[model samples]
Target: MTSANPHRPIRGGAAPAAHATLPARGGVGLKPEHFRHILDTRPDIGFFEVHAENYMVAGGPFHHYLERIRADTPLSIHGVGLSIGGEGPLDEAHLDRLAALLARYRPESFSEHLAWSSHGGAFLNDLLPAPYHAGTLARVCAHIDRVQERLGRRMLLENPATYVEFEASTMAETDFISEVVGRTGCGLLLDVNNAYVACVNHGRDARAYLRALPLTAVGEIHLAGHAHDVDAAGAPLLIDSHGAPVAEAVWDLYAYAITLAGPQPTLIERDNDLPAFPVLAAEARQAEIVMARQAALEAA
Candidate 1:
């Protein structure tokens, strides 16, 4: 008999945290602009994801809405400030706040980017890329181990959208991510937009990149839009700007990814140029259609 998710075999020695998994359906990032609409209509979104830092506060309108929305929907807490690839030690205070937030909501999944954002006692507003050599790999694995140990839950590590590569790196990005999951027992948050953006920027094949990932361990998927530009050499460059609609190219890549990984909980992410609730909801439904087609093909 074939396993449903052949690539998701248990790794590492410890058991994963006992949390319910998100349904293999479509979702969207929960934005304040759509909160009231979501509550009033109760859309058919499979799940809702929020940035962990946004709810680390004591109380606010965000929490007020989130608490109510979380009651009926599966929640995904994605952290943007964890700096999992930084050379310094993991931030204990931030980890504590994250733990509290997860405890409160008991989200179906928790994820953070593989990039680092803080250095030398300073926090940056952007997710920065890391070199993929042995030294950096070891550091990343250690950080993820610390996170899983402290949070008492398996966390997903997302691939970063990079504009440049480090010459000192000895391993591929996919290889590095695979090693992290293998060593830490964490899962992968396969960001299709990130995969496409980074591949287009680095002159690699996007499909090849997807095939290289440890897809079976993917707990969730992210689909966002990117801004286009030219490099110093006048070649095409792509930025992972979550301000626009998902590009047609990204949608194609997403379809390919769905076929490879089977249907998973996919999220349509938009953080800028906020649109009405209906527009985002439409896109989320579009993802569902794509997944449904894949399922039909597999069953045939």
Candidate 2:
């Protein structure tokens, strides 16, 4: 995959002068169920990520453990409710809260989805997709600009796992994302599982889809499992459920992605069917082994 538009640059802003950075290794989503275990055991993982909304409060146990765990290990703050693709202007109040959260943690990396989840003062619980065209492109870029300016750091925009496409979209998803990154100077959070799921759902080649992305801008990679089924027309339909373990097919795609983007800060995300801490830690270790193998191949 040749570089697509090499003019990508990190935008300037009043972001914090000093913040932690994610190492090019493997990480796991920080879950409350494993908080105590993590504190006691302190697993040898690269980093731990948590949803920004979970720690919006002034004080609580979440902060208690996170404050400690963060001190020892690198942290990545992932936001899911910013609704960056909304048709409306960015929410100032929500931005204010997000700004405060970032200030407190000063995570190494921060990211959000390329999907919308709110409208007309009502919030949707899920990450929704938007049409890829000039209008939506402008909106997404504007939203990202506001977020980077507010947070004072370059944000990574994760590609969405889509089950549907819009006829109104005049541009391909990859083109739209490239334009947004080139315009706003934000990084790309390459979710390998989402890429595979979207490609399979839309009958596109997964490897080709990965090749079209702005791989050079990928600061991190996400690996997750999906629920499989068939669409109304009996075609393969994969849901970004994030419930099961990383599938073998997705692992293969992850290796391919590493070959293109090099060893990124990969995260094994399992949001449902909660497993033991060791289970997640083992997955994180497996990701590390994969990254090491790919690195060795490049060396050879």
User: Quick one: how many clashes does candidate 2 have?
Assistant: 2
Candidate 2 Cα misplacement greater than 4 A, ranges: 1-18
Among the numbered candidates, top lDDT falls to 1
lDDT of 1 by residue, 57-131 (tens): 899899999999999999999999999999999999999999999999999999999999999999998999889
Over 4 Å off in model 1, which ranges? 1-17
Using Cα atoms with residue i matched to residue i, what is each candidate's TM-score against the true structure? 0.95, 0.94
lDDT of 2 by residue, 1-300 (tens): 113322246443233345545898889999999999999987899999999989988898999999999998989999988999999988899889999998888899999999998899999879999999999998898788878877878889999999999999999899999888888878999999999999999999999989999888888999999999999999999999999999999999999999998888999999999899899888888988999998888899
Computed on alpha carbons, the lDDT of every model, listed in order, comes to: 0.90, 0.89
* Residue 80 lDDT (model 2): 89
